[model samples]
Target: MIGVIKALYRTQLLSIKGIWYLFCSIRLVGMNLMALLYVRQKLCPRQIAISENGISINYCTLYTQSEHLAAQLAIHCDIKPQQKIAIMAGNHNILVHALFALARLGADIYLLNTELSATQLRDINNNVHFDWIIHDPEITWLPPINNLPTYHENQISVYALLTALPLTHQMKIEITHFAKITVLTSGTTGRFKLARRSGQAQNFVSPFFQLLVKLNLSHYRKIYIATPIYHGFGMATLCMSVLLGATMFLTRRFEAPKACQLIAHNKIEVVTLVPLMLDRMLTYSETRLQSLRCIISGGAPITATLVKQVLDRLGRVLFNLYGTSEAGICMIASPDDLAVYPTTIGKPLKGLCTKLVAKESAANMRNELYIKCAWSTGGHYWVATGDLADKDADGYYYLNGRVDDMIVSGGENVYPFELQQCLSMHPKVKDTAVIGVDDEEFGQRLVAFIVLASDAEQTEAIIFSWLKTMVARYQMPKKVIFVDELPMTEIGKVDRKKLRQLLS
Candidate 1:
């Protein structure tokens, strides 16, 4: 008994020492290394920065490869500082390297959505007038333009370029301003606009520090980013992983089963994704998802039903982040908040303020949410979100769909989200979207596009009957359209405008 006690004591002492050593290392070396990457453009020569598909690349090699490519761009491409360059590619090692290399060269970079068609791409370029286009070889749909150079991903392969470059430490370039990263809006409603980021340290520091404190982010060392890196949510997660000295696991595409497998295989502790990804992932057995401790869902409004399902299946790990391209992450619903108010977007983050401007009626108290944060556009104190929301007595905010999405049927206001929540409760419904469409009688009528569960046969009459029990008569969808799948934006929100276009 005495021997066992002594052994246990020794083991405890060793564990404590190990923790102290790790804490010291992270504070002393890890933080300095990250700062060096941002300020001095110096990469950690020996520390692993990124890992994908069981392959890893240290910061030194990543920097060297980026330097080689930057040199080539400077010589062959004649790309200069502050010139607008558009990059259209899927998430990969090449994309990561290109982002850093262009930043070092001080170019204004636009990360175009990979899902854009040739016509859309052309339209965007015609409006923005990019100086150069760097795209993946798979993007053959891009139209040719006179005197404008297009660099293919295969041409600037980091791995291939690294093999040819001489093994030597290259001097770091001093960029006065980090490359301004421009992300295009989802364009689900109408024309897409550029949302530019200055890439300043001060802009990210406050929110990042708050996130670290509130989300307990240090606990998550291995992260899997399931969203497209071109989007703000995905990009933010990537930057946070680098800042925290965490290992990241990424794939070019997101498949539910594959995502689950990757999470389990890689022991991914944190997963940042949209609600659609979570819904799809939950279709599989929960036993496959043992390693995930936190799931960050954002980029769209998640239904309460879906939130409950996630908590039940995946434990209380769902955290909903609410924000837009114009306004960065303003509100974040922690697991505790979700437990209390399932659909609440939670309170404003530190250094952020929110107010509701009543547009319709003061009695109703539902208003458009206006926010002011460090990341707001044009340094405005109050940036209009164009999204309608309701705040409870407890200060939790509930999104009531977009302001434009509200439909008035027979002189009664009907929010599509109310109908959507009602429809989502139906066990037969796999996915659902509600939109307002023009009507000859009513100013606008509600239309519901629903994807039913596999092997579940339910007629429109039955669904309408079920919905009648939940929502008001005026809120009933005038038309119920059955679809194999609803149109989704790149970030996984239902594309209401696209659905209306299809109906038209």
Candidate 2:
């Protein structure tokens, strides 16, 4: 009850005036008018709502542009409500407009990852059977599908649509169907799975409130989403920023220096990024990031070293968010929580149920984490996160890497993250990742990939000797491969799959 009160206060929903305004806004949005127009009257016409890739658009322009774009889609493409359409593009103002436009048309939207291969895109299309595909011109490798209408940016003419007058009223398009949005899984280790969610504002209340109270998102008016919008983390921040009436700074791709410039120039108050991006951004000057009040890091694990660096350099402003594509957002560790335990993922959010399921015989060992939440893909039953975790006495959760990524060598289970964490403590080691491979004798053997510090002259023999002191003989990696750098996923996680392929 107290948590609810605090969330309400922090989100400005506790005051009578705030409640009344919210009530009015909800009522207006619930009416037959387009949903994006809810902010048309609330915000100033000249207030920039989106700034992406040198393009700035105010709320009025956003509404008008989306409306015009929706009309064009309806007239030219014969797009109808409930039709499943996939959008494959990076972050841009046109993509934002298309999202709003598609929402108004009540289309089942699938946000495709920009990093998807031609074959992966085809596989998704085979299952989804999309009515149309709207992609950017830069996506040149998209395979041609039979009877699937593909429209590039040039064919659509976004600038002309943005400059055109609003034709929604004249078009007389009746919006009776609500939309459902789907985001693809990271597919770092395996095939991609579609995580679906209802597009209603009511469905997002719990997660939004949790983030509002926990991250203090209501205070931030300038937000920089430094990750791909196709991913769940980026999509969530995009919706929340819009609901908060905040200005969003988006980029087609995340470049460390460019991100620093945007944040520094605009005085960006909050930023949503993956840990890899955060680490890269730290390589630049700290002065460029001084304006940040909240740095929301998610979509990948935040290493202890990264946590220490953030606290030491940026102060206590880093917030670590943990969730899966299937589960919206389960836990968030604040700066204070990290200060206490840098490895903790914090307590579960309000109204969320989390448990670690272990075997009856191995009750003391780490087990898979299960989450039951209103916003997750699992409606009522608990969903297995596939990631192994254990909770501390204080209810903070610590991840033990992916369950599939675990190695069973000589009848003993070995978690790669534990070995990686231990190996990273060496002063000469810059970065490291661990993977398991098939061994003729041990069934599976651990392989460690290392990136050494620039000034260090470290050898595999020295590191192996050092690691022997840290872990048991079975837990020690069979081989230590030195590399210039590790391959990273689109969201910045070390691509273990790629590492395994390197062995092949």
Candidate 3:
């Protein structure tokens, strides 16, 4: 009994030490990021920093072009301290710069999606109170007349407004000056949960970039961005790029072949993607990514097959960035980690704390992941991460997909992503989605929706062989339906709910 108790005590002590070490590491990364940003501000100052017109900003332009543009926009904003200003737009260089300028001016921002309908916009506006609306002329106008702004974006888009707007060095950064941004967690559907994060909460991205730099991610003089600017990943990435002195190429939406060509032609070194976008890029082998060094996948789980294909074809430059807008940036899979742990999401970001809790239900046991931030959005919303992960005995983390996405079959727990990754390995398979279907016997049965390559024709045996090799027997899908393409959400992810309805 004494031996067992002593061993348990030693184990508990080790766990505590690991957490402290992790926290210290994150503090160091944040410090490096802060120092680097200060350095760039001092030495790499430019009114309009850019790489080429192939990009909006080119090598000869100023590093602070977006900053200058924001200064001008701030004049129109008439923004005062403690006021909230909402920014909704497709990805644009000006939007990113404008946001920082807004922060500098001590105004809170509501980063919103432009895709919501006029009625939907009005509904959101009712819930999220904003003092001013600064957004794209096109999207802002899309809202219904009722949702129409008390202020207008079109007036500025016309004539020499860019010059006539506002230009003043009047931004002061104080804790009180930083207002919380209210972002809707669910995409315009169910009751909106506002993820209100302050400037201190939002500041983690700078350290994330610094950590990546330390990890030896190839720096991009010019980056091509395609995600909607209002979304967290898009908003977060654009903000972080500013500190790196990188020129940004912002697109309205994801365009597969064109995006590929842009990366090849523009020599875009760094880019962000979800799994769906990664699938599209991999399907067409036309793009030569010689200069591309980093591809950060977030917002969803990316499969091993996709990672392997990218590494095999593009010479191994894939990264996994794990975080939510509410949590700021947390864990990331470095390029080197991908080489060794083909399945893990790398290690925690320096200073970020992660733990594996026994997932408890009324009846079953599973692993629930808890990520505690060292500098997590430090107010109103500071709970541990809700996602679940299975930590190996060796301390690597394996994402078990989202808690809501898990399914039970024949008394065994099966993760949807575990099945999807298996089906995707088939040569005939182009992409795949797995969802749970009601079964009178088992409560839920696994069903797969697959997109096959246009050139290849295959039988069930071949597909099953692919699945059988990668996943365990019970995890194998009970049924498979091949489709021309999987249904996608507006934000570019597989719509599993829609798939379940169709199957039902």
- Backbone collision tally, model 3: 18
Evaluated with lDDT, which candidate comes out highest? 2
Where is model 3 more than 4 Å wrong at Cα? 1-42, 45-55, 58-77, 117-126, 137-176, 188-192, 201-206, 361-364, 378-382, 407-415, 425-427, 437-446, 459-479, 497-504
Instruction: Please list the C-alpha lDDT of all candidates, in the order they appear.
Output: 0.73, 0.77, 0.61
Each model's total of backbone clashes:
0, 0, 18
User: Candidate 1: misplaced stretches above 4 Å?
Assistant: 1-47, 141-174, 362-365, 408-413, 427-430, 452-457, 483-487, 495-504
List the lowest-lDDT window of 10 residues for candidate 1. Answer: 32-41
**lDDT tens string, model 1, 35-153?**
33432223224566677777887766666666676665655567778878888776777777777667667788888887787778888888888888777666777756412223334
Query: Compared with the true structure, what per-residue lDDT tens digits does model 3 show for residues 280-352?
Result: 8667543656667877777777777777778888876788777766765666776677777766776677666
What are the TM-scores, per candidate, against the unseen true structure?
0.84, 0.90, 0.75
How far does residue 339 in candidate 2 sit from its true spot (Å)?
A: 0.3
Q: Which numbered prediction scores highest in TM-score against the true structure? A: 2
